[model samples]
Target: MSIGAVLAQLRGDFPDVTISKIRFLEAEGLVQPGRTPSGYRQFAAADVERLRFVLAAQRDHYLPLKVIKEQLDAADSGAGPTAALPRPPRRLVPIDAPAENVGLPVADDFTVGKELRLTREELLEQAGIDAPALAELQQYGLVRPGPAGFFDPDAVLVARTVKAMTEFGIEPRHLRAFRAAADREVGLLEQIVTPVYRHRDPEAKSRADEVVRELAALSVTLHTLLVKAGIRGVAGC
Candidate 1:
């Protein structure tokens, strides 16, 4: 089956799981599915069940992927992962309620920013940046105005980063690469969701929204981990 089919199958229980998360697990050698001749991922019934095991272990036991991968390896070698893999049932989220209450901060794109919309001056002050610097960041797409033509609350944090980077002589033009990378990441995620997103099914739309949120969170987690690892290596840790 396709990844979308697996996602729709598991989303009833694991609402926050995304295709990115599944692919991440696969990368970590937790669950390996086969590939088709056309390069599409093909998941078998066993693949889906193994994924359920991994996600359940993560959510219920808070087991790190390393340990889970070990369990999977053991299972593959004839030791069963069923020892600690509990298939606990979770109550389904109501269809009417928004699915994006993932505890992300206000500036995340998942939430509407109509409230606390900041003007240019307000954004500058909050971000601790001057008007000219703000214009530079805006010009390069490092930051953007909100849907209502005001700055979202997250703009202040973006400005803070920009201001600090400027002190290191990193100009807005130099930061344009970050914006470009972000756009590319967004495109990759959209490709995963667009098929399910455009479907007429309400559940499909909900799954698509949840997948985007989960993927965004996963991306941030990965970025933070890589940066921290780089810093550790630089410090000879």
Candidate 2:
């Protein structure tokens, strides 16, 4: 089928489909459209299906292009059916011998074992957070243990900070206010990052990261000014 006809059909499913977006996906190696002698792009039925899968995964899963690429690569490598989209590759590296000495592990260098579920004590040790502080953050609804008593990696990082704060005599109740403030900050960030969620372009992905970091810096600046103003207000100066 011609690219335009494929696009027209795709627009039924994705109303905002644009030529540039398709080109961007192609550039990301998500879809490979054949070209005619006249240089017109030709998209087969399989191409349309691949685009549908890519778009659906992006919209529903919030996966980035790099991750999606890895999934597609894995599928292409006989890991599974090419048409049956898989989740992002979980293996840290590929499963094969290296062609040359690259100072990296060959797939056989690593051992694959059954997923080990960590206990609460092991989790605390790995997360570098004590029990009490973890409970405090849980009370504040800032973080929670995931399935099987594990915590998300990001949550573990935050838990460590909460633990450190407790060592400095900061109570969990006091941290609850900070959690509320953080929610507001995150809401602002979501507003700015929403556009990045719409398409799967590498440039847009980079800009999204920059936008999130910039928003975080802006939030810190605004909060500092507000705190300073409040302090001066109390001092009657």
Candidate 3:
């Protein structure tokens, strides 16, 4: 079908999509459109399906374009969809064996664990996040455990973040700033996604997800670079 017709159908599902966004995805090599003899764009059924998959993954996984590119690369290599799967498990080795005796496990051989919901206590124990950290996060509204005293999937993520911060010598009180910073960051992200929310189109949703992932990665990279640069300047001074 013509690009306009296909895009119209897509817009029915995701309203905020723009020609620019589709062009941007094309520039990123995420989607390739065919050209008619008249130079108008033509998209086939498979192209629409591929676009749907790309959008779904971006929305759901928040994967960066580089990561998505790697996944597509794997597919191109005839490795099947297994290469797109999550990281695999470490191989079991006997502790008593010599260092040279152990063989590394294949990178592709990994297990996908079931999603586990943890209670407050279970989350603390499993994630090694202290009580004070949990309390601090709660105070900052970074997370809320369910009424059943169990943490949803997001709480597990919070628990992991708390654990990592502690390892970095960040005290619970010091971490409160992160909660505020996160709130501000989320506010910005919401504004960015508003267009997608308003349109409710599949392609717009996909574009929203792609934008979010790219923004997040760029945020992290820029934040880390600036922080390190500041630290170096201070040390040199």
Give the candidate number with the greatest TM-score.
1
Q: What do the candidate models score in CA lDDT, each in turn?
A: 0.75, 0.68, 0.63
**Models ranked on TM-score:** 1, 3, 2
Measured by lDDT, the strongest candidate is 1
Off by over 4 Å in 1: 1-115
What overall lDDT, based on C-alpha atoms, would model 2 receive against the true structure?
0.68
Candidate 3 lDDT over 12-92, as tens digits, reads 443334566567777899778899999888888766765655554554465556667677667767875843333212212
After superposition, candidate 2 runs with Cα above 4 Å error: 1-123, 126-129, 145-170, 232-237
Q: What is the TM-score of each predicted model, taking all chains together?
A: 0.53, 0.40, 0.45
Instruction: Please estimate how well model 3 matches the true structure, expressed as its whole-model Cα lDDT.
Output: 0.63
Write model 2 residue lDDT over 50-107, tens digit each, in one string. Answer: 8877866654454556777787778879785665553333222233424331333221
Candidate order, lDDT descending:
1, 2, 3
What value of lDDT does candidate 1 attain over all alpha carbons? 0.75
Each prediction's number of clashing residue pairs: 0, 0, 7
Selected candidate, larger TM-score, 1 vs 3? 1
Predicted structure 1, TM vs. truth? 0.53
